[model samples]
Target chain A: MIARTCILFILPLLLAGNANAHHSYAAEFDRDAPMTIEGVVTEVWFKSPHVRYYLTVTDEDGNKVTWDTRGLTPVKLVRQGWMKDTIKVGDRIKIFGHVGRTNKTIMSILDVTLADGSVLTSRSVAYDIKN
Target chain B: MRLILVALLTFSFGVHAHADESEFSGMWMLDVKIPAEPLAGLLEIEMTDDGWIAWVEGGPAPVTIEGNHIEILVDARDRQGFLFQRKLVGILENGRIDGTLTSIDVVESAAEFGEDGSSWSAEAFVKEPPSQPVQDISELSGTWVPLRGVDFRKWTMALTPAAKEWHAGYDARMDEPQKRCISPGLYSAVTWSFPFEIVAANGKVVMLYEAFNLSRRVFTDGRDDPDFFPNSSMGYSTGQLINGEFVIETTLVTQTVRDFNGEPISENASMTERYRLSDDGQRLSVVLTLDDPDNYERAPIRRRVWTRQDDAVIYPFECDPDSFFRQLFNEGRMQEYIDRTPIRP
Candidate 1:
């Protein structure tokens, strides 16, 4: 049933990714320790593998730190009411997700919340076909 | 099959069948398919007097080829650079060649062999030389756009009934990552980069996909399949020439989702693609055949021509999945989309 549901609407990239075409998250991102960092939006990347948003947050000792949060694709985010400017540069935010599996890159965002009391989950969100 | 195996042994054993003896000594491309799939970037293989040489953009190594048999130090390093290490034991008589690759080293193999052997092989032949070296078109290189839906835009021809049925499910996709710009494997990225370059030489075709800048290599040498083949997103492709068209046969693709719509391609499908260039070499026609023993009974799936769009270049499509999904969930409408969507069988 799930297959049929998505067959007609399956995007090329989704179909391709579903094909498991290349590489692996386990091969690229750390899976053991999942970290959640709260910061301010510095930049946002809505592209493949996953979406990324830069959050500039201060550590517990008040030192400013930037955490790169990676989240789901825009197709999934559309259901969450995310637009091009959902989270812009200089916006206070909190991000949560696992660390990069390869190359020890910055923290990959899993989810984020804006200073305007808005929270968004980046993992996987269903869409409303009707609306 | 046994006779072919014997030929493989002869070739690998360094018996020196011919003065021009070389594992990959010709040009290759995708020819035909139960359902046609395109021959990626460029497929070329050249064996010089010194050694067998291969070139393609995007793969691990652009220049690599070794002696007749498995030369430990020579092969080991080349294997790592080649992205796959394989051995084919077969007989080589005159210009005739037949054999199978017996080992594959891609990480995807773990799932196919289960720590054992793989059941995959490739067989190819040399073809007449091209009238002239294929000229490179600089303007004709870059990423284009998704063809409406995967099944909507036709290339040079139309899809076979089976392929049509295979694509019929695209309408049900949930507009997930694609609308958001996720790397759609290596092939989808190809179409997106219309006018992309296809480097063909020797016995291989390298598809320089400009989307996420990923490249796919389709081998055309007369090498056989490996003993242990693995399941992957793109599966494994071995190429050859039929007439002037390059035919590539791809198999062992792992089941993958096309988009958030839950559209899926079964692992059992084997695809064949034919690439033909029109006179003057302006237009490139590619026909794809999708044959899935598990999904279809008869008739291969088909897709038509992909017109060469010149002015296409590499431009980044900013796709952020997190914010996109988050905003949707916040509206409390995420469940509604899922409920209305019908599930695939």
Candidate 2:
């Protein structure tokens, strides 16, 4: 019985690891810890691996720090009706998303608000959502 | 057809005196004893007073030839409508061809790459020749359905533990970009399409992909991969006719995974494919052998067959998704989704 129980337990862990081997955001973000920030879009560097947009957030002490926020590709953005000129540097934008694992400059945006007061949400539901 | 002929007549072209069609024309089969890696299917050469017209059963549309010039059209569908274009150029006996393939009536995406991004361009050449054209081979041209995914469907690629770990890291975020409708980069696109196109000319052969306007130039021109080459998704390939088969050997790939997909094709890998057309020009067969030091434990050769389909036209593949979420996030809406909703257990 103990052997069977251990087998059942270890097998699931092995399977889960295999499942996670393909690709996941787990290594970069913690699901348990969630945070949101509103900052200005300071710089945008659109290259491969992924496109990144830098944000400048000033602490209460008035010190300015830069954060690199990740975004989708130009092709994906274009389909979402985004033109090359959609977002620009120095734009006063508010972003909402998870703080990367490092808690440094990396953030994955879930939604955004443009300087003109327009809104676009990037949140998605689980592929199989109940309720 | 008349319009095409007129265009051919007006186009500036040249060829060697022995390069005439009579000696090279007529459908020919590959004699298998040539000792080439990947052999080509039945070979057909049709020469007219003006030019030549040829096709490998399952390859791209019949190539139109005029004097020394050759032309093929590549079209795909995108947000901008049915993207169609023509690539017109000339073929030479010494294995050199200069040409420009242009997008006909397509809208350029609003994106710009500083002052450098421009339209696509490339230079091509003939790679090899067979020992002798064989007769009585009629089972080699047509659309082949690969039972597996594009990359590893045939060859078994064994990844190192470190390589496997890197794959996990990439896949996690790779899909995030793919969900946004990005190009998925180049690697993902090639393997995305299960069955690719194969075309055979006199001493040369071509592989046209339905994936990302990606085409592999195999020179049956009797040369080897150069000592130095630019890094590219598809490695440099040198081809030639061993018997009557067109065999191509490729090496020096960039070794970058197209995306998070677990394919580990190495830069040092050498791949060879053989093509042959069956009689009647309705069947195509391809035999691929992959030799990679980094990814595979042992070399393996795989085979795939395609049937002729008159209606298989290459279409534009444009991958795009929405960007409003990122824009909104930029404007500060990150907390709304994460906090309002609970993570499903």
Candidate 3:
């Protein structure tokens, strides 16, 4: 109900990119291919390694696309001051992140702006790798 | 092929061995085969006041000689922090050292870094590289982050049959441990390319690892390792200042393969790490050795360096695994997860 936006957005310039030891940011995600997937949250799996959200988005051809978006670990997300119930299934959300190299629908979500305009960030795997 | 003639820099104090022993006592440039990538390093056998001593990278290894045969053991951990050992055995023939190096897995899992018997050859270490002035042990205390590219695992190991089997069917997209909130132990805890602060007391050395907020304490007091210790990802450790370098020996490590692509960690594994600072104290270099005899044919070494970042903040990395289970279920892997995870009675 309360809107708290960009709390984990340390610095826009600094958040440009980062890579963790687990999944190489540059090797796995394409920072050059930034996209926004706006749709209803079909599913949510908030856990370690990362938190994944499956969203049902309509593409250019009006085809339904389920974007598999990821964010920082749940530990990190919780630190950003959100509960496990922050975003639930069927919630309309907008996700900004880099797309996966092999799967266009797989993404490393950077920020999630909820329907109430509150934004939370999973900028843990941000990396400044090249195009 | 990388032949560096290491002149007897500190050989004056060591007594010369017999002709047979002399054949194996010299500097050697080692080139070996592994599954990951091609790797080479300097291996040396020289005499010391106590008798014979072996050197791999810049650390001393335990060596033994019989006739023209040489056997050496050096302990090291991988970039992923799996503790293992290297056993280098060679025989002198045709004026050269030719032998097969094997890795012994201390961890219980059959790691993929095993080689049944891989071929390895070495040339005499003739001339030595210009040595830099050594920094004092006190230089080790500070916040440090890995130098770019230093933390990546370069050298590889030969996998065992079981490890190869796991790796053959492995899928990173679905099975990476971090995907389940399993933060890597020392890999992310100590060498995460993030800043970690080392604070030492008279009795022990404590390291504050930033990535997972992992803290490690290395007891310096003269005490033997516990016969019965609890299993942990971060193994128990002890350390002491040795000749201006900070050396730490760790054991009682919990077997791990969750993060290392199922690279096996034997149940009885141990690790040895030596940390040194550059002459300017601005850089720190660490040589890590993994001798997984169960999985590999030779000792694989990892060398890393870190630079000071005193002002760097140790970030937060709390891992939670509930979502991983949820993902597995959502992806129709609940049965697989349940089957793979074996619980104790």
Candidate 4:
């Protein structure tokens, strides 16, 4: 029973190793620094290589800051039933992602919660397996 | 009674041989399993006045059929614009052809057909009763997503000494073009984590990639590469069907790294790509062979498999490198990137 369980766990890791993001997520995003930003969607570019969502959030200083966050490719999002119109302009949503190592307002999105209380994961194969 | 039975057996063998020869003409779906992965392609065989003419994709080659045994030689170009040869030898039985497929890398071998090559067992299937309807050859037109269960970046490459030195000093933060929203070029573009749509029409094929919104135009109208065309990331491409596969040759690409790891491709480097759809049309496979004498000891072959996803939409990839760098500045890591980045003299 122990051997069978080990095989089940190890097999997926082996398979998921190469099935990750096209580019190196670790190089761009800081895995050590995770952040959550709740803001209104300013724009959405639901395109390939990655999907970008711009959000305007009010900071502690009462200044509106726009954060540039991106998620996995549209292909992965489509598999999860997310469409081009999933997030529209002015939609209030919460984003959880890894901040860029050099850029604070740029993030690699991991999960998103819509205003309607729907949570969607934007994790790629590599990021999903690691985190 | 024994002599009469022997005569009947001989007569039945003759009839069966004649039936198998007639059945060899038709469209066949070929499934070949290489050591790394399985490949699918379409083969069409028709009887002509000279002999059996087989159109593998759109490249036409003469096929030799003797009894139940068949032999065909296909002069195919890889993604690098190098001509390679695939020799298929199959035996027909029960409406199925089982054979050996051998690929010889001519550029590496310096011979028309390489002396030592890779061979795999291949099976060709005909549409039997109760089988799904065969997909039209033109159904290769549509959006395709990279079938990502397996990692293609792990393939070993034979880098030259100079290439090895260049790769050793690579820093992903600054050197990786994709990070700066630059086009990853053809080799990386095909296998990137995105959807690429193929539009085929009127002697032209256009591939729209979601990565950087890169688009490649392949002329099938039988025109040679222009003499004075400027080099670009995507390069010049011409395509034709050869041996049941859509073969595209790209040349005059700008000198760029083939992948994120900084494997180099010279401006003179060329790529030959073969795109084939499975019989059921559910899967599309591409075999890309790169020929760059300046960067590698041998031409490397990269195979990519994509599943048909009708609902998958290609989105515009407008990259903002300024925003990316701004984020780094916000995180206080912009200085770190500058420190690690090697300044080219």
Question: Which RMSD values do the candidates have, in order?
Answer: 21.5, 22.9, 16.4, 15.4
Identify the leading candidate in terms of TM-score: 3
Per-residue CA lDDT of model 3 for B1-345, tens digit only, reads: 123223353242233325566676677876666544334566766665556666565344667776667776554444323344566688777667788878765322213254437667778766432144344444578877655333324222445566545544544444454556454555335434455788876778888875656788898887877778786767788987666667787766655542343344554666677677776788877756555556443444555667776765555655666655654565677787666554200
Candidate 2 wrong stretches, greater than 4 Å: A1-131, B1-156, B172-203, B224-227, B242-245, B258-261, B278-280, B300-303, B321-345
Task: Give the distance in Å from residue B316's predicted Cα in candidate 2 to where it truly belongs.
Answer: 1.6
A66 in model 2: Cα distance from truth in Å? 30
The alpha-carbon lDDT assigned to residue B165 of candidate 4 equals: 72
Tens-place lDDT digits, model 1, residues B200-271: 566666666544545677876768898888876567888776666667788877664332222344677677
For each predicted model, how many residue pairs clash, with residues at least 3 apart or on different chains?
Answer: 143, 69, 50, 20
What is the clash count of model 1? Answer: 143
The lDDT values for all models are: 0.44, 0.44, 0.59, 0.65
Position B12, candidate 3: lDDT: 27
TM per prediction: 0.37, 0.38, 0.55, 0.55
Can you give the DockQ of every candidate in the order shown?
Answer: 0.03, 0.07, 0.06, 0.05
In terms of lDDT, model 4 sits at: 0.65
Q: TM-score of model 1, chain A?
A: 0.64
